[model samples]
Target: MRSGNPVLSDSTFLDLGSGAVLSRPADAMTLNGTIAKTGFLLFLTVLTAAFAWNQSISPAGPTAAAPIYMWGGVIGGLIVAFITIFKKQWSPVTAPLYALLEGFFLGAISAVFAHLYEGIVMQAVMLTFGTLFAMLFAYRSGMIKVTQKFRAGVVAATGGIMLIYLATIGLGFFGINIPYIHESGLIGIGFSLFVVVIAAMNLVLDFDLIETGVSHGAPKYMEWFGGFALLVTLIWLYVEFLRLLAKLQSRD
Candidate 1:
């Protein structure tokens, strides 16, 4: 029931209620409802991403204002995401907003990567969705069970990666850079590959959490929260894939 995703955990459903049934469960959460909400949030993300993408590739090329969109999206998305995490009930309103804000960031970043490597953004997008669907199929087919050990391992690995990233950032302020982790050498490639695998494993955990939420008859609004969590993982996976690809391409 545990998940590497910070937004999802065994306590997620329990925190809503102890019973499998709710008193007014007429519109309780369902797997289908969560799926629909996920699609809608993705649509919102794509819609805004397209706008930012076009802006980045305009005839004038990346403008001085590009950083505005990038930082605005990053800071705004973080704030809204924290709000949704703490106030699950606000997910219905905050989730779509988060997606839209994230789109601004993703589009600008993707554009920058695309400029560096011609077709990298498309490759990353394809691989990201491919990994997502492949993991979903495996989860649905019982090929990958979310056993206690599996959850714990993924959670531990994810925490370790987060700490490494935090250390890198902290050290950055002192003008020191982590050597292999961000470089395009063999060690960096290996590190990126490991992170990609960990990010992919997280999808399986997210799938289990959504299924558990539905089976527990969680409140209808939880569908939005579940979808938001899924979107968060997807975004993370995509970004990791992009980084991995960039590293590989840099070697050329």
Candidate 2:
């Protein structure tokens, strides 16, 4: 399906013409692409809305969000995660939903940060996109490669980061604050930098996966799936960049 011509659309996967090729392989890519794009688009829309609202509310008060709005995003993200895990076959639908929910969560969380650090949200977004494009260019220029060793190391580092973050959150339940989590300090800056590196490496994996899907002649929908994965990674990288920049500015 992906061979021959480079028609970039999801409908190309489903041919109704009599005696036409089934193109199952093409369907795979198309499905993935559609899902990824749909999810990411929905997420961006929601995120924009949330960010706008957050900006509007900032002048009125420090903490203006309803608990339900915050909780809705949290619960929704969990639900999307569960659905994606249990029903991989339904990624076309679930993936985009996850993006929407995550957008909500991110927008809300970002709002909270905006309260403490003025103008940080915008700064973070620009940095995030900037980093994403820079990494993409590096990969395309052969400056970066997704080697087996690199993949393994990045995955391991990412897992470690997730664990540490979870631990930090859990500690919060007991009213414990790991020093420098929000403070401007060497440790905090160092941690943020590390996360940024991991996040950038993740883009390598994302690029490799997309190329693989395309090489295998995956269906048009696969673009959506591919886009979704990249979007998620970019969002994460952007937030970390935002936090790091904020910390640096606070220190100055």
Candidate 3:
């Protein structure tokens, strides 16, 4: 179940307290929780923006194109990513900012999809929660363990999927269409199924990270970071599910 950094494991830092150093183990779970909660709040802010944007429309449907505010979310997410990866030292502040950006992106994406497929948003939300809870339960019951090999496989698959998606998007700039994407074809459905599995596995990894953090007794700030990671996975899973369901519906 232990992936990532060995230093993060059992790592202790010193706090300068009244000229005396106090040693404390890193509480990653606390950071994770805080990050997750902050991410939710950020998501709410974006949700509100999405709601306002959608409400301003004359026609209420998917045909209504995603606007600038939606793009803002996407751009914000990218910025957050850059900050998180490069400015790792600023995570205490940057992590929360990343969550807020992620929230807006998710909210905007969800709104767009909800408009297209009637009641699909609710379905996706329920499914997301179900998958998350189910995975947590399984992990807690000793039914699942995130082995190094498993983590490697999942990460590789996730990377492949993201690359393909990015390529598809790039192609659109030249007016190229990748046939199966956004289509209700068998290929599209299969891709969705594969991604869904990957996303679900990611949840397992996230849970492992959280448990690892708690066990190591990481600093309280780590809970936010842990939660943030989990939230990202959940959002990704939810969006994928929503798209998959919509494609199936379109085919029907």
Candidate 4:
């Protein structure tokens, strides 16, 4: 099984796919269970996100989101993600924690964006969910096949995007700007669109991975892992949508 999501990559589910049958069928992963857990994680994320967002607002006007939320969320979320990734068995606990941490960071950053560009957060949320359901439908309907070639293409494209982002961040240390790619110009818009498309494609791969795990009778705890993986992709997708919408709105 392969997925563009780093959390659900090739090795993530290899043992299950390699004919390692579970001794207890009742302890195996289930579609319904995965769905339920995903919903719960999403709820926890939104709950904390709303809390953080509310904390950022005031009667005086929008204020800077506290640095604590940004730094704490980013660092805490990353650490929890790494632990969950390396210890898949810990997902049942770490996954929810990951969502909670991410919510604070997402909320803080989103508040900052919403302050600069009114209505952008709502637009981004709508677009994110719209793309999510659309992609899920396309996958379920077999409109998009997860062939080997498709997986390879998405994996390569995702890697390239990561490299470009890393390079951009590294260059920023020396005060070097990536120029048009980060501006409200055509190139920036196009780049964001490409990233959004790739993010959507990764969803298809994530769905495929979830199905594979179910078919292979992966352990029940994998339900949490599967949900965690989906959340990661959704988070990435949402952030990209925010960037894309912000760029589009900046021109107006």
Candidate 5:
């Protein structure tokens, strides 16, 4: 199986040898288990996100301080995510922690966007979940098949996007900006639209990977891993939506 998610790659469900094999078939991964785990992680994310969101909106809260939570969430979540990726057995513990940390980051950043763009955050949230369910239905109904060509195309597009983002950030240090891609102009809006579409397509790849993992009878802990991977993609999609909406609003 293939996925554009860095965590849900082809080798993610590979058996590590005899030690990786589950003695009981019942202990193997299941689609239901992954759904349950994903729901739990989402709950954790929302719980912490509410806390940060509340802080951001507080009367005495300074927007400047929000970055503490934002950077903390971003850096800490990355660390935990890397640990979970390298040590799949630790996913059950790390996945929830990753969600919580990521919530801190997402909430702070989202609050900043909300402050600037009024109800843009809500619009982005609605669109994100809307796209998610729509994609899920499409995948389940076989409206979108996980063909090799499809997977390859999505992966290639994702890689290209990542490279462009890295280059943009790299140029930032030299006091240079990537025109059009970061502005509120037509080109910038078009770029964000393209990114949003690519990010949404990644969900299809993620779903395919989880279904494949369950079919392969991966370890139960893989459900946590799968859930974490999905969360990563969801977060990416939401953030991109926020950026796209913000750019569109800026044009007004």
Candidate 6:
């Protein structure tokens, strides 16, 4: 099944090239290794994110620091993420770099939301992880099946959302605002809720895809690649949670 995650769904595993260089048992991807790599990457992300968060909340304020950390992270993270995707073998190094860079962007934006709605970042963080574990539980217990139909539906929805975002950003250059965005209205809240659900569901797809890769005896370095793909979904989920929480808080 094609995963909704861009990195994973790009058919990276399919690049095994007719299995001539199939991984040896001792050098194949494993669940434990992937989990460990993921945890380590998360640690790097949080460490840098804390630093960026502190910077954003400093006397300089978000506006003054936005270009430095925010844009730097955004641009740098994308560059590294693309490099990792195109050169999956380089993931061992690029994955950690991507995480650290992504943290800056996440932290700066989260600080902006926190500034607008007190306690929002903490609440969003909680909800994001809560959804992650909940989805993991559902997946492991077979409560959530990653059927072909389910994967296709998710991919379609995610694609539509990406298009919407692209259009919104494109229009922003012309000073056009999308009505359902940042309005704190019923539509805005509902839209955010939907995106959060989709983001959470992508985790199930990621899990299934990772298991598939391991079973196929993918190279061990794929552990890092898997972790990087997961981080992409998680960062997306967390940002969506922040937006959802902020919208709900604004209604109060």
Best by lDDT: 5
CA-lDDT, candidates in order: 0.88, 0.65, 0.65, 0.87, 0.89, 0.88
How do the predictions measure up, each by TM-score? 0.95, 0.78, 0.78, 0.94, 0.95, 0.95
The runs of at least 3 residues in candidate 6 whose Cα sits more than 4 Å from the true structure, single-residue gaps closed, are 15-23, 59-63
- Better candidate number, 1 or 3, judged by lDDT: 1
Model 6, C-alpha of 57: deviation from truth (Å): 0.2
Instruction: List, residue by residue over 57-84, the lDDT tens digit for candidate 3.
Output: 3345532344554577678767775665
Error of 4 at 207 (Å): 0.2
Candidate 4: C-alpha lDDT = 0.87
Q: Cα RMSD (Å) per model? A: 1.7, 7.1, 5.0, 1.9, 1.7, 1.7
What is the RMSD, in Å, between candidate 2 and the native fold over all Cα?
7.1
Q: How many angstroms is residue 84 displaced in model 3 relative to the true structure, after the best TM-score fit?
A: 2.0
1-252 per-residue lDDT for model 5 (tens digits): 588887877778766555443545787889999999999999999998888887766544437658888999999999999999999889999999999999999889888887788899899999999999999999999999989999999899999999999999899999999888899999999999999988888999999988887887888899999999999999999999999999999989
**What is the per-residue lDDT of model 4 for residues 13-79, given as tens digits with 9 covering 90 to 100?**
5444444645467988889999999999999999888878887766555556646676778899989
Tens digit per residue, CA lDDT, model 2, 9-123: 2233232243232346635464345445745665564765476456435565535463444567668767775665444445567667777766666776676667678888898
CA deviation > 4 Å runs, candidate 4: 14-23, 59-64
lDDT of 1: 0.88
How many residue pairs clash in model 4? 0
Looking at model 3, residue 42 earns an lDDT score of: 48
